[model samples]
Structure formats: structure tokens, C-alpha cells
Target chain A: MNKTIINRLLVNRNNNHLFKRTYSSVGNKIPRDPKYAVINSKDIDYFRSILKDPNQILTDKDDVDPFNCDWMKKFKGNSQLVVKPKTTEQVSKILSYCNEKKIAVVPQGGNTGLVGGSVPVHDEIILSLANMSKVESFDPITGVVTVQAGCILENIENYLVPLGYTVPIDLGAKGSCQIGGNASTNAGGIRLLRYGSLHGSILGVEAVLADGTVLDCLSTLRKDNTGYDLKQLFIGSEGTLGVITKLSFITPPKPTSVNVALFSCHSFDRVQQVLIRAKKQLGDILSAFEFMDRPCIDLVLKHQAGTREPFDDSTPFYVLMETSGFNEVHDGEKLSSFLESIMGDELIVDGSVATDSKNMTSFWKLRETITESLGKEGATYKYDLSLPIDQFYQLVAVMREKLDGKALVYGFGHVGDGNLHLNISTPNQSYSKDMLDMIEPFVYEYTSKHRGSISAEHGIGAMKSQHLHFSKSDPAIHLMKSIKHAMDPNNILNPYKVLPQ
Target chain B: MKIFVPVKRVIDYAAKIRVRPDKSGVDTNGVRMSTNPFDEIAIEEAVRLKEKGIAKEVVAITMGPKASEEVLRSSLAIGADQGVIVNTDKPLNPLSVAKLLQKLAETEKPNLIIMGKQAIDDDCNQTAQMLAGLLKWPQATFASKIEISESKDSVKVTREIDGGLETLSMKLPAIISCDLRLNEPRYAKLANIMKAKKVQLTTKTPEDLGVQLNENLKIVSVEEPAKRSGGSKVTTVDDIVASLKKHSLI
Candidate 1:
């Protein structure tokens, strides 16, 4: 038998046990797709020839383990080889060769994704984009930045902030998540209410298709009326259609003045009233409007260090309002007047304004760290949903009633965007299948009935691929499959993701 | 005991610099102005001394136009107890500044005075030395580390020299110029900035200090450094030698 066949046999023997374990979301054991080729010694030599650096080709079990698992630790793969390409040309050559050999490849950047989109499901080759981090160019006049796919989000922000500009997106994982991954997933963050979505801000993208054809759509112009916007397909394709190599996005000017105010609401209805009033009063200056329930705040105080309640008395809900503007005096006056109006109208029970940077950071932390604090409680069933603004907290209420004290159910997220992060966890900090079963189809059905998105910002990776039907129509999904087939006929790019099997 | 710290407002180090059209000096119009980074380190050290209970108060003083009061406010936000500004629109040299500071020192009578080794704009490392000379006090320059004695009458400073460190001990009422490794400055909190507006800031003129501006130096013109040209490729050692000979650099 050939050496490649022998290696494939060994890999199959090793993964035979994993095949018996079924995934909870898909409710089926995902067998290794037989069409994909396994990595052998010859394949490693080929990768080494293209990479030209021995350190870039990771074959040791210890070195490649981090790439094989995701940040959530929910999905693990058995990829035997990992390759880090330093240039777009190197990535092109590697992908072209892999396409010819019918080997599956997973393109990863930062590997901080909540979904298992960046990791391989089976013994596929891992294409890590860790070495291709560089800022190609930045137009100071136009405020457009062109950077490689592997640059960390926070690094780019720091680079632009001193120049009187900043990247429009801001996420909690900014210190680790890569800009390329952000564009690929169409990440919606706190600044979305002010700067809009990546679809509007990302001017151009350079990507390589499954056949190694370089699609150079990296245009820096704000307006391009040319035929089809081909780059939009790869924006949220989750690396299935192609690999995003570089991006050019417009950045917003850094705000000279920022003010934050935390408000305590008696009920969810009061929170909505406060939001309505804030939108009308703090018109062009409102940058963020986020909310968290009392339970969420309680968990943050219990788990997160150096966190305290913003008010003396506890309430049913809390709202964090942020404002950014150019004139400090004008913005400060506006924020104070808005606060006074809301308090006088009895829309809020209590409120506290952040008089300094320390208070501002602490107030934002109380809202931003809710997700991190929830992870400490137990195995959480996380859902990022987009629903009607009025019915935002109804699902959380329904789940809380359904679980009936068995699990802790709470809600928090960007209220300005109608996005809610509904989380459920047990008190014992263990993964329970019964709890997951009670949450899944019902959650999807409720979301579908409300005509809401089941997966709001987090893409439908291996976790929610089967549940995509709840949000997307049959015709829309059919067209998506056709597009995927037309772009990648061999299905060698990020298999078993985005599209349903 | 009280400590006096002198801060200077200069163009932000990160801002792009441009020369004036008349070649007189660098253009300052529309440029971001900030407290000299070294002076920020000096203010940080003084505030830390007060926090440690070694110094009872910190007084930040600056001499410039009215806009320079922003730097004094910043220092106040960073934990200075009081501020004093010598309001002067006319340009002042190192010697003129030293004379004004000497006049203030006679009345304030602070136990210690700390300042930056040099201003980034002029790079003139003379004000501290001149002040110490005029006051007849011991002086320590390029101080990377500082330690005050238990009795608080003397201090020890570790200076960063070319190849090694030098330690110097000075009596009370000494002058110390801070080096880059002294300490990292803290950002001014918003609450403190709001409160800094109410801090007592005394304003005085150069005439009020009984000092007349007398400058001994004059700058005829200012120009940017010459741009470097690209080098030619050489294939052999003889070619390199020929290139060097052509440029008269051999």
C-alpha cells in the first residue's frame, strides 16, 4: 500500500472513537467526509516547499493542538498538519495545490471565534493565517485603512487612534480577534449604532476562491457602481466560499468627547421608554444603548472582580447609555439635559453619570463583561437573536418560566440594534443534555414565529447550521447552496459549515 | 514638606511636524499641544511622593501664554494640589525661565524642585542647572531612580550615565532633573479633570516677578534636515569601492 494510504488508515483508526460521539446541535454523528484527502508525509513536504520555513509547518501534536481546538473548547478536530502562510502568494499556491489534491483546508485567523468555523472537523489540513499580519497602507485624508487579514483588531485600533481615527468596530474579543475574521463574519459590535455595519464600512476585500483564483475586489473608493458586488458574498460566508486575504475599510473619526450614564429601570417597559426618549433627545450623539437584567448584574458582581453596582438599590433592569461627539461642552450639556428630562418624567428610577474615565470604563465593563461572567457559572447554551424591539425580553421570560428554576436564564445585549444575547446555564456548572433539549427547537420556533434571526451576529457555523431554516427561507437557502456549489464544487473549504448538510 | 514641579506645554510627540514657510520655526497652528512627556513623568513622581506621605503638597508651575494653563489643569487632574502660571506671550529662553523660577523660589521656599532633563522642542538641558546654580543648591541630573532619607533632609538619586549608573546624595532643597526611566505617568481621570477646574490657580506676569526679559541668543533661520538619497546597487567589491570613491566617502 502507498504511504499516504497507510497514514490515512492510521488517522481513521484514531478517529474511529470520535465518530461514535454525536454532536448535540446537529443531533447526528458527523462522519469524516470520504471525498477529502488525508495529509501524509508527501503532503507535508509539499507544504514545506511552499512555506519555505520549517517553523511555519506545524506537525507536532503539541504545536498543532491549539489550532485544532477553538476558544470555546466545544468543538475539537483531528487535523494532523497545520500550515501558516506569510504572504498572499504563498496562500494562493497552497490553496491551488490543495484544490488539485482534493484536500480540505480550514483558513483560521486569531481563532477567537465563538463558533467552530475556524477549526477543522476531521483530519483536514489547517491553514493558519497567523503570519500574514501587516498594515499595507492608510490614507490619512480619506480615513481608509488597508490591512492584511491577520492583524489583531485592537492593534489596528491603536494604530489608527493616534492619527485621529479608529476602526469602526469594537468588540470584547478585540485584543485577540483578527480584523479579517471580523469582516468575514460581519461582526456587529457596540459601535454599530453609530458607524453602521461592516457591509457599509468595508469598502473592498481581497479574497481567493476555492480554485485558487484571486478575486481582487480591494477597492478603497466609497462609491463603486460596477456590476455585481462580488465581495459581499464572502463577507459572511464564514470562509466557505473563499478565503479573505486582505481588507480595505473606511474608519470613523475618533471622538473628542465621550460621556456615559447608567440608569436603573423598574421594569422592561421603563427600559423601552428610556430608549425612546434617548433616541429623540440625544439624536446624533448617541453611540451605544445597552441593557442588562438584575440577575445578570448579580452574576457579574459575584464572578467578576472589582465590579460594583452602579446604584444603591437594586432594580429589575439597568440601562447603559453612551454618547460621543466632537464638542465637549455641547455634548456635556446635551447629556445632562437628557438625564434630567428622563428622571423628571419618571422613565427611570435612578441614574448615575460617569464623571471620569474610571467611572466610564467601569460602567461599560458592567455591561460588556456579562457574557464572560456567565461562562463562569456553568456550561451555557448561548443564543444571539435579533427580534422585534418590543418582544426582545419575552423569550427570556418564557425560557425562565419554562426552566422553572432548574437553570439560570438571563438576557443582555445591544438594545439599539434589537440584538439580544439569551443565555441559560445550570447552577452546578455542568453540561446537561436535558437542559439543551428544552431550549433548542422551541427557541428556533419562537424566533421563526416572530420573524427574527436565530443567529444574529455569530454566524451559523457547525453549531447552528441545521437551525438556519428558522431564519432563512427555502428559496433563499437553495440559492445559497447553489452559490456555494458554483464557487466551491469540491467542497474543500470549511466543510459542514454555514449551509445545512 | 512641599515639592515644586515645572511643566512645559509642547507639541504632542505623536503629531506630524511641519516647518513654517518663512523658515523661522516649526508651525504650531492647529497642532495638538500636550505637556512634555518628561515633565509628565516629573509630575507623576511628585504626586507619588505626596501619596507616600513623604511630601505634604505638590505645586505645579508653568510659564507661557494663557493657553498653556491647560497643562497646569492637567497636572492638577493628575494630583497636583495647586497651580501657578506666569502669563507671558513673549518668547522666553532657558536663562529667562530660570530667572523667573529663581524669583518664585525665594518666596515659595519649597524643600525640593523637580523638572525634566530637557524640553523636547528646544532640547536645551540648562534650566535645572541654572536654577540650582542661582539658588546655590545641590543638583542631580538624569535621575532614573530617587530615594529620600528617613529624616527627609537629604535624598539619593540614581542617574543613567553612558555605560553605567551613577548615585548621588544631595541635601534638602535640591534640584533633580528626571530621565526617561523615572516613572510612567498616569492618565487624568474625568472626575479629577472636572474638579481640577475649581483648583486654585494663581496667575502672574513676568513684571510682577520683578524680572525683565533679556535674551542672549537669536535664531537666524530654521530648516529641516537634508533628505537621504537612494543608493546604487553594487555587484562586486570593486564596484562598492568605486561607488564610495565617487561619493568621496572612502
Candidate 2:
């Protein structure tokens, strides 16, 4: 049998088992947990008293609807009230009152999450951290910065970049995502290959527990081995553990020179080879290694305005690589040699290097615009997965064949960290439950079988709660539940998320 | 027409200033250095003029040690066409700097010389005026806005005066000292910073420029200003009056 045909047959055979298994009762109308108390006039009065500003207390339906819906618009709740707290004390008071009253509260930062984590699934009171956007303090010598959780990521970057420093994380939704929210979801972006994840970069985090006790663990020291590292819990708790009010993280010095190059690879194997060679050759200066398939770029060009195709002849894959360092001449020489060797070895067929910032920005746009373009294609089933680098593109090919003529399956992401963003959309741009059924369990099962993560950077909010077992073991799930119970006994902090009921 | 922009490398504004143990000067060891903020504004203004097609080229000049070339590179990154470094490790007074710039201006013969009103380190605020006087050109100090005539023969400058605004129109070949409100300097993008490495940068010594350095002013001693003492809290008017009287500040 032909290799491609054999692979397709194997995928089909494996998917049959997935099809036989029943759906995990996801996408059904989730009933609001009745154990939690509903928001009433008395709760509103208490919120008004605590949040003195009239504008902070948003009770009007028009004012609260935006907070009620997730950014993807896939999940919408009937949240009746939204309270924006300006200080950590106010957050503590609100959470304490809600915990005592058994009134569920959903803590929202910029609300720019994909998994519907930041929005309420029921009539939970929305706690908006919009008013707490402030840079508390910054140490110029050590490059340690403390910012309120409500501070937008881009705003913090803007504030620090001028001072010869930069926030460690960079994401596609930087303009809207809050730093606190970034910490809560443990966002892994293009620069993760260079700066590592927030788990290591975030030095300390201040959070409010379910009962309104403020956990002040905002440490600025880089090395502290005292006792248990409790701040790590809030880093990726998805706001289920607590509400992160402020965070202190070390900012790396801004790179004096940045160089971007776009290359066309004929195969995923070649892409992986280029990544390995880049890591070996470029060494410390290597910042990002992002890859995308032909369909991903095509959709971006089709849907996104002001975006032109990077290459005249579209190939199997495209890679966007960036290098940042102190000396431009040295970094440029290293990059030139790397590019030459890769091209000489025929690992890349065609390539273009940006000589100016404008061109570099355009190169990054091709990779960053994938998510926004997928949304424009309508009814996208987005999956952020971390797989073995060798099998990264294999899953995309499998989904493409399985959903052939039924939908468009495109893959793109930060290949440097072995993470892939797989997006599937209908040709007619309409929602289909049958299409949903075909993709879910099979994708999860295939990922599990290959020892890949079901949710890589985007945490398991309400959307993937049922599928947590696919990635974690029963003991691990039980431990997580036990922790949730111990910390938030009333289940008031972001109820119906992260853990399976 | 050509625009000459003079930038200076200074201790970064964000870096903390610490006096040396010998009380000679502020410690610069391992501290970040950047283009003086006001000079960055001057560079931005010159680049804006070139972008508007009023100037054919922008030549940024800096006089200091070899490390000063970094600021010139930053100037080029912000869109200057060329950079000139007056190599001198020795500190120069305002008059000495004015003399060297006078020699360069005579040779370059630019239509306009725009520079910062004062370097933050020295705060002398006399170099631009001295250069204008030495070159015998009309001078506009503390310029908040500038406009050139359609024929490009003369220019108009809006000066930020102590109490109000002052507008002056002068012929070509003039000097204008930039104020804080002149323009906001743009960030030197990484690509442009790399491209700046290819731009023309000439290195010449003060002797090569046919100018001799002379520091008429001498510093006998340098001392940091006295630390402020904490003020005591007073709850009543009588208590405030008593404290003020005790200190003889009433």
C-alpha cells in the first residue's frame, strides 16, 4: 500500500473506536449549579456599598451583556450584574461576601479567553478587574515590575519597553488580554521559546481566596526556596482557584536588535530539521520559531485585510523565525550562516529576510493573523494542542482527510515549544453539531494516544472540563478536586470549570 | 537644504544616580546609557523636517568618547541620514563644544541647526546660543514649533517663553534650540537599528576639526544636595504654628 494511503487507512481505523464511544455529555445545556445562591437586590446593594463608584457597579443589561459573552461568542451566560473593583481590598470584600452568601462569582480580566473561561456560564455575578489597571512599582536595576492584574499586557509592555525592558510574555491578544489574565491562563506565546513560560517567569502573584482572604505572595526576589511555592497555584488556576489581583515578574532587558526571516519548507520533516538546526546554530539569540501550513496562510490572505501572500508559490509549509540579541552585526551574521546552511541542504526551498521593522511586522502578521482569520471563516472549532514535534503536522493531515469536503482543517502555531493550533471550520461558515461530534473525542483520543496534551496553553475552562480525564489521570483529577474543595469549599469561585463534576 | 542635529549620550533617565565615593561625579559603572531625552526630541524634529521634504539630509553629530557613537547610531535609527563623532575623552565646557560645532557648521554649511536646549547632565543651556553667536546666525532658543517658508529662504519659530509664547521669523542658516514640546521622539525600531549600521558615520578628533578644547570653569568640589528631613505631623493650626515658629520658618 502507498504510504499516504496507508496513513489515511490507519487514521480511519483509529477513528472508528473514537466514533463508537459516546460523547462526554459536553455542549449540552449545562444546568446552573443550584447549590450556589443567585444574585438578588440585596447582593446588588452590598456590591454598590463596597464599590462606591456608580460606574463600577454595572446592573443594566446593556452594560453587562459584553461581560456575559466570551470573546469567541461560543459561550453566553445570563449574568445579571457586573462589578468592577478598583483595588485589591475591594476584590477581597466582594469575594468574601459572595463566598459567605454562597453567591457564585466569575472573575474576569480582559475577558479575551478562547475556552470561555472568563465569562459566567450562569447568573453568577461578574467581577471585572478593569479598574485595577496600574503599575504598582518597577525596579530599574533588577528589571522587576509589579502591576495590577487589570493592566492590559500591551500597556505594560509599552510602559516597560521605553525603560529598556520588556514584559516576558507576548501574545496575539496582547491589546485586550490583561497581565493577570495571562498569568491565570499561563499563556504560552511565540516568545515562549526565548523567555520560557509564565510558570518560571512569574516570580510572585497576589490572589484572593474564596473566602476573601488575601494571599499576599508578591515576592520580587528571583531565588526563594522557602517552604511550599504557593504562588505557583494561581499562575495557571484559570481563575478557578482564586482571583489574581496583582503580579510581580522579572522583565528582561529589551533586545537592541531583532531580525525576522520567513522560509518555505517542502515538508514537515524539513520544518522540524530547520527548528533543530536553528536551536543549535542560533543558540541564545533564537526568539521565535513559528510554522503554518498552506491552508492557514491561504485563509489569512482570504479573510484578513491588508495582508499579502508571503510567497508567490505556496508550498507545504511556511516558517517564520526571529532572532533578538545585543549586536545586530553578530546576530545578522549568525542568521545568515544558518539560512545559508539550511538552504544549501535543501531544508528550505524559498526564503525572505526582513531588513526593516515594517517588513518584520508584516512577516509576524502572517503567523499572528491565523486566529482572527479563522474566526472570520465562521464557526471555528479551535484546539490548542501540544504534541511531539515529529507528529505535529500528522494530526493536521489526519483531520484534513477526515473532514474532507465537510470542513477546512488548518494548523499553525509556535513549533519551537511543540505547540500547534488546529482550527477547523465549515465551508459554508455555519455551525454543525455533527461536525462537532466528528472532531472532539477523536482529536482528544488521538492526542492522548500520542502522549500529547489536550489543552496546551489555553486551560480547560468549562468547554474542556469533561475532557480533562483525557489528559490527566484519575488520581491527578482527584487531587485537583480535593484542592478545589479545600480552598473553595462553597464552590463559589468560578464554578463549573477546570474539574469534571 | 540640510539639517544638523546634535545629540548627546547621557545616563539613562530611569537609572538611579549615585555619587562616587571620591565625590568626583555620578557613578556610571554598569549603568545603562541612552540618548539625552531632549536631544532625542531634537533628532525627531530634524527627521520630521526631512520627512516633510523641507530638508534634503539630516546629519546627527555627537562629541564624546567612543561609546558616544551609540547615541549617533540611535539618531541614525530614528531616521538621520549620517552621523559624525567628534572623538574626545576629555570633558568639554559649553564654550569648547560651541567652538567645535561652529567649525563643523562652517564646513557642513547646513540651512538649519536644531539641537536640544540643554543636556540633562550639565544643564548649561548655553551651547546652542554660543554656537549661534560664533556662527553669526539668527538664534531661536526654546523653540516649541518651527515652520519653514515655501521658498525655503526663511523660517518661523515659536519659542516657549517664561510667561507666554514668542514667535520669530528668521532667514535661512539659523539655529533653533528644541524645547520639550517640540516633538515626541519616535522609538528606534530594530530593523532601522540594524540598517543604521550601514549608514555613513565619520569619526574625527577635536584637533582634526581645527578646534582646541579649553575648560575655563573648574570644579573644586562636588557634593550631593542635603537629604530632606522628615516632617512631623501637626493636627491643629496651633501645632503647625508652633512647629513653624520653632524652626523660624513663619
In the order shown, the candidates' DockQ scores are 0.04, 0.02
Point out the worst 10-residue segment of candidate 2 chain A by lDDT: A5-14
After superposing candidate 1 on the true structure, give the runs of residues whose Cα lies further than 4 Å from its correct spot: A1-29, B1-250
Q: B113-195 in candidate 2: lDDT tens per residue? A: 99999988778999999999999999999999999999999999999998999999999899999999998665454446656
- lDDT tens readout by residue for model 1, A1-501: 011101110001112222222233334436788888877899889988989989899999999988987765557888988998998888898889999999999989877776688888887788887788899999999999999999988888878877888889888777778998998888897889889999999999999888888899999999998999988988988999999999999999887667677888899899998888889989999999999999999998997676786666799999988888888669867876777677678888777665334446667778877767765665678899999988999999999999999888989988888999998866544545576788988998999999999988988877788889999999999999999999999999999888889
Give the per-residue Cα lDDT of candidate 1 at A277.
83
DockQ of 1: 0.04
| Every prediction: chain A TM-score | 0.94, 0.94
Docking class of 2: incorrect
Q: Clash pairs of candidate 2?
A: none
TM-score of 1: 0.69
- Grade the docking of candidate 1: incorrect
